[model samples]
Target: MDAQQFLEEFGHIANAPGGVGKLRELILSLAFKGELCVPSNEISATLLDDIERQRLEFNGETRKQRLTRQSNTTTNLVGPYEIPKHWSWVSLSTVGHTWGQKKPEDSFVYIDVSSIDNKAGVLRQSPEVISASAAPSRARKVVKKGTLVYSTVRPYLLNIAIIDRDFDLEPIASTAFAIVHPWEGISGRYLYFYLRSPIFVRYVESVQIGMAYPAISDEKFYSGVVPLPPTEEQSRIVAKVDELMALCDKLEAQQQARRKLQNALRQSTLQAVASATSPHELQTTWACLADNFGRLFHEPEDVDDLVAELKNLAVRGLLSEASTTSPDLEAIKIDCAQMRARYIADGLIRRQKLVGMADCEETYPAHWAVTAFDEVAIVIGGVTKGRDLRGKQVMVCPYLSVANVQRGHFKLEGLKSIEIAADELAKYQVHEGDLLITEGGDWDKVGRTALWRGGVTNCLHQNHVFKARVPSKQLLNEWVELVFNSGVGRDYFAGASKQTTNLASINMTQLRSFALPIPPLIEQQRILSVLSELTKHCNEWCRQMERKQAMSTLLAGAVVSSLTGITIEQEEEPMKAPQTELVAPLRLGTTPDIKAQAPLATILARHHGEMSAKDLWQRFGGEIDAFYTQLKTEVAHGWILEPAPAEMREKLADSVSA
Candidate 1:
């Protein structure tokens, strides 16, 4: 069917998420049914004759022999009606020798599914030397130069490759394989496509065992029936599919580029807004962004970036530029001194060693007091645990675990319920407006703090949380939150932290010694109000971005389905055409199979004389892909980045030139 007609019939699939995947399945089913192409009179006549001859030959034998031959072909084909006219039902094994090779020895050249491109059905390479034990067995089948190999273990792996070079063959595959060598007029490429169809994959999955390691058996492999076309038509179908797949690849690339550009534009808009330094500047920035709201935001990530920028701006004192007058330092200091004296007299708080500093310069806002964090608030360590409690039955007390602490904030998702005696609840009960700081974690998060807004009435904290119960009458909780999240707090936390493996942590003493910039109570409230309003705005923008992202994802899937969708007619009809003739065998390259290589600098010069490291790595493909994947995972696990060599710049420059 033509593209336009196909779309008219199955257009709904194009608009749904994962619709393209369904379309691909439909196309494959139709292709096998011979409905993808129109049939000619001559081809139809010849196909009918071939079917009749086969039937006659079967009937000529004794009833027992005939039954056995039919069973060998397709046991479930109860009658000739099972196969359409001008169509023949035969096992794929009829075209190739099954279990053709036996292992000759312990070592020989070998190929694994990983070596093949699952997408293009081409063999990809690695440079690492394979262990002698891993070499294919001596008796493994020798695929002829034009034969195709499909990985049977993961039917969906779609690892099909056409053999070109005649290597001294070894028992190449694990028992999980169904190798196909086309007979005189058939095309291996066409057969490869047929095997990749979702219908075939579903057939494989139907019999596969084990959820974790699903696999199809060898017996099942040789039993499944396949649709075959004339040799010439097989070539035509193969060529058409290849051209269309390439077009799909180009479309995917374009979509990815568009998404990237959209993200960049969103980021730039956020940056521009954040650069505003005054109320007028901020108003101008807001106006520009408000005008282009639809254009600037498009995904959840963009909104997240904007939220981060808002947090940064809030801490930097840019969010409240309009009503943020100079803070009154003397008044704040007097108030803090009074509160500390009262706490000491009541013995409600401890007297900790505080950090002292010289008076600040004029640039230090006249209305803001600079003092050690201890003077403004008390910092205490969490209760010590005496033993491992993994399997113990404890009370279900709402408790904060180490994971609950974030950078100057708390995330309550996956909050754990701990076993604490009802009598001991008084000691750990969390109150509204009380700040909880992470006492031990990565250095950046060690001193992170968040105020509890009392989401739960009786939630208590765990031993890992250091509570800072501040007086709401004197201090603004939002102001404290902003300070703790700011860069100044980050630097102090980093400096006081002690490193162990991938983690860095701080003790209570570090928190007490940390300096803080305190503003007058009124000024703090003003700052808090302005920051709260602006952050809410940023949050709203983020939500819109997330919605857009969902839409984009849906759209992309729809487009993909449109390109690969199968039509209604193809599913019901089977076409007869001449078989495909192979004029040339597929080319397969041979290279060492090492998985890891020297640093990019060393490899760049050898591969591309003067190319950038990025360009050279892309050319290499496999090792670089593995390296980056590993690197990103390590980083996520909190490993620090090791410094790259200084010579990398020169190497990268040379690669760029090349």
Candidate 2:
């Protein structure tokens, strides 16, 4: 399609999921290919001559050095694509030379790589003025007005900008950049646009070395090819690109405003539904939502919010009719007491000192009785870590850690193993119909519980997890798990858990004392049955939303490919196979294989000290589950150390020195 046709169809593309970004890429691709503007009769001979004259007059020695450096990398030069007949394919160095580095004589404005806003193609923050002695070593390249600055490292980030005017103090940039001083022939804005093009980015990606800190060398960057249009044509192309980009900005703003309005409407509608005082009012509000569902719930997150509100309403007894039979509280209390006494008499559990329920602010149906969790089930703490088993014979068994436990579900992937003594196995082993709850992690994860249906054989849990087993059949494990995963349960856990920084934990005492609203067996089963059907519908709707989002993405890709004559199939190259190591593959639930642990151990040992989990992932570039599996195994064997807090690290250092 022609430029005008493309511009006209831009709205359609921009409205698709992730379409705006793809539209921007298409604009850049078209502009660089000389398809955005009509070809001119003007020749580039005069422009080239003028550029050479200006370069020679500015700094002859610098020009000579650039040429010498370019000569060495001549063999590495590769043309990205053929240019238009009216345009000339020339090296970037011919029209611009990188500015030389200079140490600051006094305090100067330091514009590091982080200072540039890649998306807006401008400086987001003011440069900092530091003393010459305090200046960072990387802050050595000097930028002047009209100079095009492009970061050499991680060129895919597209941290490229043109210095429009001079600063109050001399502006210095990080050595991570190659400061391009365009000669008379090149339009600085045009060069900046080209630098940000997908072709240039792909070229940089191909040549960039190192996975963690990919960068293009100065020689490679300077010697890269540029499609040079006539000087006047270059100006026209820059202006056209700017105008198109501004249109894209407006389109993006319109989309954002629409989304904001939708979100506001959604929140208000949901609030109305939640605040309904009667079933009739709720039905009316829900009917309104259903009528406008297509317009209101366009995004997957919108569906998620709706599902959450549904769950909240379900637990509040608003979703269905309350059972007519009144619960026999005295009979339930007697039965619970007798069950506890029988378990204690059989030596299956220890006799516990009970704590009275604190005054709770929440109210439930009259048919439901408010009681502590211990009244409904027995809460047991999981096996302790680092316990001495010197004389006790032990067997390796698969166990559930905090990672394995999620809200309402168990992640059976990468289930690790632990050594459990033969006699202590029964105490730690998880049984069917048990409710597994996590003790700590981030605050949101503190009270996450899931039902255990014997998915894994002989599965045990770590100390950070707690197990709640219902002694009587009156309460279902699914019902209890639903209660804990609901908003009411989340609020209780958030308020009751001991919070330190971002992490929170709940001890056995807190778990046992948790207040549970118990309904009669018949009512519980009725509520659960309705919840099961509604939840299934919600999940199916969410899956439909997911499929719609995927289709939108595919449609966007197809549009871009069709316009650029670049097939979508060609864009997606197969991912490189993961690097092989001498270590054997890890087998879940098996005894730790020394060979399997060797690669991870070797990697961690090479590092001086503890590293963040993010940094560790960058080094391996493997699947997240694989990385965590290795990490868990190493931690189990004490081959790698966990990260310590600042105070602890300082104390350890001082003790080591002494």
Candidate 3:
């Protein structure tokens, strides 16, 4: 598409997923490919001659000196795409000279890598002036007006900018940058846009060397290819790019404002509904929502919020028109007592005193009775691992771990096998109508439970999971699961769990003591029926949202491909290595006598012998490779056990597949 047509269609494109950012990238790609503006052979020939004459003058200089000089010869460097005959492919060093490193002599304005806003292609703020004596070792490169500073360290960050105006003091840049001084015939802004192109980014990614601190070497960066357009066309491309980028900025700001307004409207409407004290007020608020639903709930997350509100209203008996009748509280109490006595007499459970209802803060409908979880269900713990099952004849059975249980659902992707004695299967085996709950993990994951429908035979659960079985005809498992998965249940579990740093757990005692709101059987059936229908609709809406998001992304890709003639294929993001249990003993590899070592040495020393490499990484923030490198250093010094290579590979593969 032409520039005017692209601009005209931008309003529609900007509403697509990630349209603004993609549009910026597309502009750069087209500009560098000589597709944004028509190339002029007459103008390019004149500029090429002038650049070649300058290159010849510096041919006599030494290799060290030549590193900063332009080259006269065209080395036949091939770019990702074919350019016009008038435009030529040349090394970056052929059109500009890199400024040599110099120490700060006096007080100077210091431009660190962090000072540049790569996305805007400008300095984030004014550079700080620092004295020569106080200057950091990395502050060594000097720059002047028309110079482009491109950070070589972490090139993926695209920290590049061109100096447009003179500074009060001579500007000194971080050594991490390669300072490019464009020749008299070249447009500095044009070159800056070229460096930000996706092709250059891909090239940088291919040549970057380190894991945690990936960077392109100065020699490789200078040798990198760039498309050289005619001097007159370069100015046209730069001006066009500036205009489009400004338009993108405006579009981004407008989108931000629109989202803020939508959020405010959504929050206000939800609050009005939640605060309504009477049925009439609620009906009015709900009606208002229905009228404006198309505008208020534009995203999937908004629909999710609506679904949650619907559930809350249903449980609170606000959804139905029929008013609640007073429940037989005394009769419920008598039935609970009788059920407890029968269980104790049959030796099915131990009789324990129950806590009073005063402990609960929640209020139920008039027709609902408050009861303890233990009064209606039998809560049981799962089998413990690492016991002596190896010594005896055992059956290998699939077992559920904490990972297998998610809120209102089961994730049976990685069911593990455990050896249990054949006779012990009945005690550990899971059955239909059972509610599986997680015992511990992250703080919010303490009580995630889902109903089991006997999907797999001969399955058991680990100690970190708990199974609650409701006696036949007492209460529906689905209703109990719904109650526990609701906000109230989540709050209770969060408050009741034993919390450590970033972790929480709940025991059988706490689970059994949980107070539940129990409505009459008939009322419960009605609530469940309404909830099921609403939940199904919500899930279908979520699926539609996913499809819409996918279509938007595809449309964005199509726009870029059509404009730049380059197909954009999405690549899967690399996953972190999986965490594993450390079975081998660990110790310090370095001697305590050593005065200095790695920065993580102090932290590693504090860890007891039982801690694993993954635990150390969690405690200290660093890339996985760096952690492994430090770990290897300690292992070399006999401070810790070397990890098994086979295990590491297996875990890495698993993570990649997942």
Candidate number of the best TM-score = 2
What is candidate 1's local distance difference test score?
A: 0.56
Candidate that beats the other on lDDT, 1 or 2, i.e. the better one: 2
* Model 3: lDDT to the true structure: 0.75
lDDT of each: 0.56, 0.75, 0.75
Where does the lowest 10-residue lDDT sum fall in candidate 1?
Answer: 566-575
> Candidates sorted by lDDT, descending order?
2, 3, 1
lDDT of 2 by residue, 128-205 (tens): 788899999898887888888889988888888888767889989888888788887689999998898777877787
What is candidate 3's CA lDDT for residue 234?
88
Give each model a TM-score. Answer: 0.62, 0.77, 0.67
Clashes (N, CA, C under 3 Å) per candidate: 41, 0, 5
Give lDDT tens digits, candidate 1, residues 129-232.
33455554432654556777777665666767776555543435544555666655567777777778754665677777777667776556656656655656
Locate the minimum summed-lDDT window of 10 residues in model 2. 643-652
Number of clashing pairs, model 2?
0
Cα RMSDs, all models: 20.9, 16.7, 18.5
lDDT string, candidate 3, 1-658, tens digits: 5567667666556777787888888888878887777667554666767987876774533475365334424546677788887777877777777566789889998998888987777986677889999999998887888889999998988899998779889898898998778877899888888888887887888888999989998777887788887888889889999998998899899989998899899878977876566568879998998899777876788787787676666656666554356445456556656766775786545667764332678766656777778666677678787777766778889999998899888889878898877767876789998899999899768899899988788999888899887764545678788888876788889999999999999888788888877776667677788888978987887776765665566556656665676655443233344454323334455543322333344445666444555556554344555556766676676555565541343334565869
